[model samples]
Target: MKSRKAFGKLLQKYLEGKCSESERQLVEQWYELIDEAPRQDYTEKEWEALEYKLWRKIESESFETADESIESSKLGFWRTYRTGIAASVALLIGAGVWWYLGNQDTNPATIATQPTQSEIAIQDNTSSKPIKIDLEDGSTVTLSPHSQLQYPNHFAANKREVQLRGEALFEVSKDPEKPFYVITNEVVTKVLGTSFYVRSVDATKKIEVEVITGKVSVYEKEKVNNENPGVVLTPNHKVTFFTVEKHFITGLVEKPLPQIKSISKKPETFEFDDAPIGEVLNKLERVYGIDIELENDKLSTCPLTADITQQPLYTKLDIICATINGKYEVKGTTILISGKGCE
Candidate 1:
């Protein structure tokens, strides 16, 4: 604890510009010592990871500090990392110019080739956003607006892997021997060629995966078994996994929002003892062609047994607004909901 306190104080000085030159030298030396400390005190593995994290931070800051260089913005922040102490500070430059093709974003049409796992060259990212992809394996996917799809120039015989940040629908190319997998935020989506959607942009929750076809399994990486980290999701299932909260839940089936809304079909009534807030809002947006908002997260998960009417959009909105004792406002192209935690 004493060493930790001392270390913490030293870091504070370094950040605050309060460390004397001599003290600074001592602090740097101490940092090196701390970096290689034993696992009981400070694991070497963790130290290596910490070094990487610090370097990444440095690279990001360095790039961000170059706001004066407008064109350099196109130059991605890919400063080569010091792989080992003896390794030179290797620097590789990716090409410049960000190209937006309709809905796909291709960065650097003629960038210098590097040894990458896979490269996704975005096309254009304007309209017809969110390109949907269905692999040969019956897996379905909806690529988020302004996103790119990159796979191993070709997949290996044993794995179907992809990385995502924006959003996507994935109906995997099913191969039981080579399970389809996705790597995101220290968690993995493993499937035997099933269909699912992943939204990996929630800063708090950050990632939401919904199963639209077959069963998919999700769990944290390198965690203890006692943690009981995740659950298998089925069709019409959704889960919002929060790293901070350390929990993922199976949500209630949601009706289509106007985003997925179709006409003529009356709203099919349903009851949710513990439905997710996302599906409820989406369904209202789709079915009745109106927006349903929850003012409080506390009410977002509150169970409701309302008999929703699939009447006309306005009629359904009126019934919902009255049922929840709330108000709705329309702005430009989006609708907003206010008040009511649900009864």
Candidate 2:
């Protein structure tokens, strides 16, 4: 028999990973007993007798000097309605058991159960084209063929969360107070209002998130916290999380588009005639919202004359590099250009 305060201290120690081997085993045994109690059937008389024995055990335990009298009074209340309290405890055990073990350090080999009972699951098994789903929060999801999505009928007050399997394109409605979250097996993507694509069907357990508009934050599901905020992606950028290695790699998307829809009302003109290289690159940066760096300051003085309005971003870069005898390479999410300065 242990006092309530002693049991609370032991549970706190277990949560903090500071319990000794024996103490850890004791807490786990308690968890197992509570987990299995809901399945057992006992008559009302048996239940009352059992609760009487348990209460007597608890009341017999001696408390510390400060809590001795207060704990005695509390035990007296439990003693009065011990039978009814026992039934209530049995009803709540299954629902509340997760609170004890959910925060424990998880082993990589362990598989977590999907907790989406309250959500509506939709699997695109027969659809030839992507299925569009409109959420209650005004967000939209384009579920790809053979993909699956689980979402609540109504979003929670503080946040909007949905689960995804396979692939989908999300167009989240703008709600700064209520951020949106897309949860998968490996990674979690968060945004206020943005359009992004998430793919998690890779055979190698790779999770990919590509941003088409606004901004997104991507992080591992198990390692989520304020200190480790994970990677932040903007328009035209993408991040890949390798599940096996637990690593993140960021880069530009294959075909970067102008950030016109979100940033600018009118499309930018990409036709330049004898414009300074710096000015041309600056214009490109503004239109695309991607950083471009020049290795040499003298390259800014070089003149460029080209009409790259019809070309893709990479093609535009190719033409620019060829004209100035330079080469460009992508590092993370930025494009770096290096070449000899004009005479």
Instruction: Using lDDT, give the best candidate's number.
Output: 2
The positional error of residue 275 in candidate 2, measured at the CA in angstroms, is 0.3
Please write out the lDDT profile of model 1 over residues 1-343, one tens digit for every residue.
1233344445456656798997676545434522432112222234345546555655554565555555553534222222221121111101101111111221223111221422432222235667666554455567778544444444457666665655777878667898777656546677886667877764556577777667788876444133563677765557777767777765633432332323556435544445554466667655433335555555455444455544544454455455457666654224565657566
Q: On a 0 to 1 TM-score scale, where does candidate 2 land against the true structure?
A: 0.65
TM-score for each model:
0.41, 0.65
lDDT of 2 by residue, 184-261 (tens): 776889999999999987586899999999999999877665467789999999999988899999999989999873
Clashing pairs in 2: none
TM-score of model 1 vs. true structure: 0.41
Where does the lowest 10-residue lDDT sum fall in candidate 2? 94-103
